[model samples]
Target: MTDRDLTALLERATEDVVERDFAENAWAAALAARRHRRRTLLTGVGAVAVAALAVTAVQLGGADHPKPTPATSSTTSTTGGTLSDGTAYAVMPQEGTEGQLRDFDAGLPSTIDVRARAEAFSAARPPGSVVAVYLRADGDDLLHPVLVAGDGRHVLMGDVDLVRTTDASGNEATPLGPRAVGGGGRYVVFPQRDHVLRLDAQTGDTVSYPVPAQHVEWAGWNAAGTRIVARASEGAWSIDPSTSRAEAVPVVGGYEGTFRVTATDALPSDVRVTRFDEDGRPLMSTPVRGPTWSLWGETVNTETLAATGAFFDQNVTSKVIRRGYGPIYQGLLVVEPSSGAAKVLLAPENPDGQTGRVKGCCTVLGWADADTVLFQSLGSHGRWVLAWKTTTGEVFEVARITTSAPDDPVTPIALNVGRRS
Candidate 1:
């Protein structure tokens, strides 16, 4: 094919991935491009091999195509298995689309975090805004707080970015912090300099409340979603998102309440992770045997499910990767809260059988209760999702989500689980 022809082919593929709402991530797009490049390289590697094998595009149809069907959930006994209290899952495509998984019937109600912008259909601007949830897709270190909703009707709140990043050189940009949605899907408040953006989940309406403009140590809604709390240069204060009111509460010592997640690299040979009760009592302390460890969750929302990231056998992995290997296997540990014991739930990442692609990043979303933890794998054709049981170490199949557009490319995006009232 001509160079121009190859360019067109790549563009077409990229368009397909994007139209499919696979992932809105630049890394994911790069992966799609690299996959295409690898395919091209493989085609030229051997002529005799081509003659020996012939494969077709993914299809199980005669006339057009048959799509993937969501697998029904199978759980182990509740004695320690993933809880199936009819928990529903909400997904966000990398392309900025959001919706609920009707496939296995999460059985429980779900609410998703989103930044709702006030846009006018014909010029009169709509009112209000919403919340943001930072997610680490695939195994990427960067966290994206993309806005997503449960109904699939995503509303862009504004151009304001919602995630913070610190470069390798120690420079930080977009200092957005952690935020949470209220119980029963009610309201949440996001902080911005002098003004706080508050929005209701059910309605797209938003209200801006004023606050101290100085940079705060941290800002987000309180656990109850009743007010916006932050530790400004002066002290920690809680502001009612509705009234733009502030109260001088005791400045939380960085982390508040019982610390659900803890990381200690005190020993180079053995890393440790521990969960604690609200009173600072250690619940479970498990030591991890690896080269590095990174904790992702604070405290358990309902259970002590936590995800830790690390690069195993660093020197060997680096050597292997330098030899033109696809990539080294980054590891994840799904730890138990009570005993502090841990298990490597996901070994080096691999391609999903259905999508034939791997996640650009491997990260844990949250728990499905005390027994199950949902993982966000945006590596394959679409966003690959899996639910892992803490006790049985069994990974349950969820949906591989994407846009329905015929030509859109699909990549994994972020995922969050919620329960209904």
Candidate 2:
């Protein structure tokens, strides 16, 4: 069939079938039967005929037709009700009293009101013995404080220093060498200055290991206190404390993305670009610039992974890659950073849906584990409370820890980040 004839047949086939009718006469049937004509045209014209017809349709304003507006329902608000700050706030469970838990801005100074009465103690160290320290949180009881202090030398949790040795008096301080403060008040005082010290804050007991000072820098640690990323003067290394050995890996350069220590050794070999071969076969080409590293793990049982990369286009923006198990437990979950919002692309499992705005000018500060990510939301009063997200992209409440005594006045919660639409 000629090109014009095939085009007309295809166009008619795309229209409503009920709209077109024909008489029972043979010639009339032949003119009305576009389906039968299509089969004959497709068989004779081949692939080039299809491409030409598509191009013609686009040129004739066919492809530019507006799509039907999708139907949508009201968004069900999760835990926290929408606050006046343009951010959402929710109340989480606390071990203390019911009023002990309060909602505050994750991006600004907020007061943590505690009704319990308790005594507070402060720890002091001699000049050269300690370098620097900061407070983490202040609670009515002694456990949660807002201020956390640490130097490249030692980490102090509450009234105890992970690296310090006490005299006859009950005191602690860092002897100095290289030490890293892991979560849960645990410190890995490394194989430095001839000893590795593991001190128990509750009992004030210390366990010392004898090893050579191999030079240490802050390598990120996992929640289990097993997987740790440390950079020595030699190269990039990961030490699994559970196995008591270090493995050397290539230096992955770029924005520091969240890392996880897996139960098995499986990570993506490399990240490259999407390209086409000379014969037009699709392939992945080597990355021209930016970092090529796996953010998530590679094992079949692996639950989550996150990585950071830079855009090569005009804006030259930075972005993060997060892949996790989806809500329904089918495929992976992905999120991309674009302009002012995070574009979440669900894997094959989700039927392609997007999320509303997740407010704040934030940078991922740390990862609690494979399931939770902590982000530092920048706002007016310095760095405020951090924001955390579950593997399924669900956000928890904003927790504000106090830096002073428990009786001190609390600051107002700042909510500047807007919701996504």
Q: What TM-score, computed on C-alpha atoms, does each candidate reach?
A: 0.49, 0.31
lDDT of 2 by residue, 46-120 (tens): 111000000000011111212211012111121222222221122111112111222222222222222222223
Per-residue lDDT of model 1, residues 1-421, tens digit only: 1233222222211000000111121111110111111111111111110000000111111112122222332222111111122111111222111112212222111222122232221114321222122222222333322334333323334433333322223332332332344432345444444455554544545666555435443444443344455544444555544443444344443222222334443534344544433222335445533333333312223323444333344443333232212443443454433443344432334322233223223444444544555554444343434554444444444434333342233221222233100
lDDT of each: 0.32, 0.23
- Per model, state how many residue pairs clash: 32, 28
Winning candidate number (lDDT): 1
> lDDT (0-100) at residue 240 of candidate 1?
49
lDDT of 1: 0.32
Candidate RMSDs in Å, in order, are 16.8, 26.8
